[model samples]
Target: MVLCAGASQPPQSSQTLLAGVGDSSRASLSSGNEGGRYELTPERRALLNTIRYAEGTWKDGEDKGYQIMYGGGQFQDLSRHPERVIVKRYTSAAAGAYQFLPKTWKGVAQELRLSSFEPRHQDQAALHLAERRGALDEIDRQGLTKDAMAKLAPEWASFPTKAGHSAYGQPVKSHQELASFYSSNLRQLRNQLGA
Candidate 1:
């Protein structure tokens, strides 16, 4: 196809044209945005709380992958992990409420800000990653599914599964426990989207 003089079509990546698809998540973000921004809600708060329980405690300067706590303490002895006390099963020595690796954090933190690595900022960064990954929309629509859980699993090790555990943890909560955690909000969240 050729463009007419002074008339042109929008540019699309040749790879996207070949695939017959654009980045639909980003497309949705642009078009279907709720007031054009993400905001905190009960569902999100509950979700973060669940992640915190899994991350265990703060170390270095982050909690779960969040810099939730402030007020300085001694520097880490030698471990790269944020916490002096270590918990394995993670693929990286990540920090914060969402356990972002140093490189990842630096990039995200810079985009978000150079100052104030507080809980709110950390939550925003985590949500930014989650939304970019397409998990937030999936969870909003499906409540929780194997696929949605899988999408979110990479971000939060303890995102639950129906099988009495999560993809990354060693059974932090029981089957009943998991159900209760989701039960209170799942219906409400699903109802919010007519899911």
Candidate 2:
């Protein structure tokens, strides 16, 4: 991985750091409240440059690879909202085609995976299936009580399964759908486990 940094002409009193690779770029600026610019300290500039370079690397593979953006900010009152992050995976093996896998959540690592199949549509279907399986794993790992899972079962039962199939289908359309699917499945799993 190559990393480079540069900047346009800095203002007489302010400094700017430019970080990027090829056609992708990011800029960081340091200025006083009065609008007087200040040069970034070497340490701060290096950090900004590193981040910019990383973003550039991802952008280089635009439409062919995965990109994730994550960060956090505070309200003026200093109460911390959980950090937010989004992951997007893109693939364009077929003409005029692309697949997108996006997930956003707080306090947990966002995961994404991509694969190429002989038929692009099948690949897309598989990706959606994997995402649903992942959600079920999360519910299990979070130690959701059996009662809570049970309470959600009836609604889960009403979800539209794939035509002629007994299991949930690809592309659950909403969080409610995913939750219901997991809840329904959990009830079955709990019984098997005698929980």
Candidate 3:
């Protein structure tokens, strides 16, 4: 998580602190800003939420995680992905709920044409990564199966491989814990759809 040389960051004074953004209901998926492309199915939403939970960014189940920087800091602007690197306990350019590294976000954003680091785009980026790793179909059909999680482990350090260790040697959530979280999250997302 070393900050590469010449990486860009906003001036400290210019970074506006956001107190919080409310829960999952706060951002409407039907906003039409980037319709169809970023639309999330319930399974996709649950998978992303579980990843957020594992990443320690599922802050109060709110949109707050969408604004979160690495090391538990928040950035205000949603107009673009914050490529700012932070060097608290760990040096990283990772931001948003899925904890995307700057390079990773840039590639995903470019491929998906995501204009902002808003919650929906973040969700879509996660999905795109999963899709690229060939785990999306399994998640859609089987929820968070071990095979799916294993395929995604390399893409997301918080996800465990089949042997139950992070692909990146970082800490990982247990399969049981992630499975429980995904199940509950999927049920909640489905209920929201019905409502």
Candidate whose TM-score is highest? 3
Residue 87 displacement in candidate 2 (angstroms): 23
Clash list (residue pairs), candidate 3: none
101-134: candidate 3 lDDT, tens digit per residue: 8888889889988888887788888888888999
lDDT for model 1, please. Answer: 0.42
Task: Choose the strongest candidate by lDDT.
Answer: 3
Q: All candidates' TM-scores? A: 0.51, 0.19, 0.81
* Candidate numbers, best lDDT first, in rank order: 3, 1, 2
The models' CA-based lDDT, in order, is 0.42, 0.23, 0.70
5-64, model 1: which lDDT tens digit per residue?
111112222222221111322232233433324565535543543344334322211232
How many clashes (backbone atoms < 3 Å, residues ≥3 apart in a chain or on different chains) does model 1 have? 11
For TM-score, candidate 1 versus 2, the one ahead is 1
* Global fold similarity of model 1 (TM-score): 0.51
Better of 1 and 3 by lDDT: 3
